[model samples]
Target: MTRCDWAENADEVMTHYHDYEWGVPTKDERETFELMTLEMMQAGLSWQTILNKRQNFKAAFADFKVDQVALFDDADVDRLMHDAGIIRNRLKIKDTVYNAQQLVKWHAAGKTMNAYLWAFVDGRPVVNRYQTASEVPAQTALSQQVSKALKKAGFKFMGPTIVQSWLEALGILDDHLAKCTVNHLGKK
Candidate 1:
């Protein structure tokens, strides 16, 4: 039951995420968008903090349904700001809506979020063999490319570092430590 060093000492929420969700490939567009939004919200926070508030986020953002969140107006923003269960960062909240809008547009244009995102990795995960936490990177060249493309597409709060973490979480970039049990979970 060995996990990544980062999650080894985490609380139940983080431990479960590490064991069952992190690095597990998902083609579902809504789930991918949800994880991407969470990573953006986690820019200056710990993953545990984001995980703890995930349910609140789902509820606040209409379970991260892109079409629904894309329709959120100023009133929705205000409500989210007053919500105690989720992070009340105004910029992050607004950007969540903006990102949803972009996702919806992509979907309408016959380019699903899943296809647009996975295209960066040629529709497969990039598995890395890091022996320790230190060996893992905060960002990579591929992440920079993806971030640049996303920013150009009107996605806010998605810097290279944030995109890298999102990719790892979505299994586009599998960064499980070599000794971790989930190290072999993603594509080779």
Candidate 2:
């Protein structure tokens, strides 16, 4: 069975992300930070844009290291504004840095972002049996709740749609097509 589902156009970037990483359990802080940052940047834009610019974003954002990104200043943001590799949106860029600071603060608060995020599913991926893309929702009550909580925590740029995708990417929610073998993340 094909390892995907579609909400609309199954563009190359989305397809690649679905096959290679979506729904894959990731425990790395850097990867989590990268995905969260990308999701925030993706607000009001297509995921394709973010995916295409991912390399540039990694280069510009110091490889998505929270500690490094938390150090970004106006100069760093200015440098990013001129770089064609990233979205160059002032608010989003600023939010990325702010989110990094929040991430670090959250870690110091006794839970790493990974723990705080993945804990929503109790450290296990929430399995879903979505058979087609049309069944996929842009947002959910869960995402709204998560979004509200993140916003309350001083993080920026996360909304329901963005949070839902991040949840899927983090493997907090499994969104594989019903026919896909990868749907289970290899859990027997």
Query: What are the TM-scores, per candidate, against the unseen true structure?
Result: 0.95, 0.90
Instruction: Write the residue-wise lDDT of candidate 2 on 1-188 in tens digits.
Output: 47664523477777767777888888888999999999888888888888888898999999998999999999999998999878989999999999998888877777787877777777888788887878988898889998998898888888889999999888888877777764435532
The segments of candidate 1 whose C-alpha lies over 4 angstroms from its true place after superposition are: 183-188
For every candidate structure, what is the RMSD over all alpha carbons to the true structure, in angstroms? Answer: 2.0, 2.5
lDDT of 1 by residue, 1-188 (tens): 88999898988999888888888888988889899889988989988889999999999989989999999999999999999999899999999999898888888888887888898888998999799999899999999999999899888999999999999988898899988875445532
Candidate 1 residue 59 C-alpha distance from true site, Å: 0.9
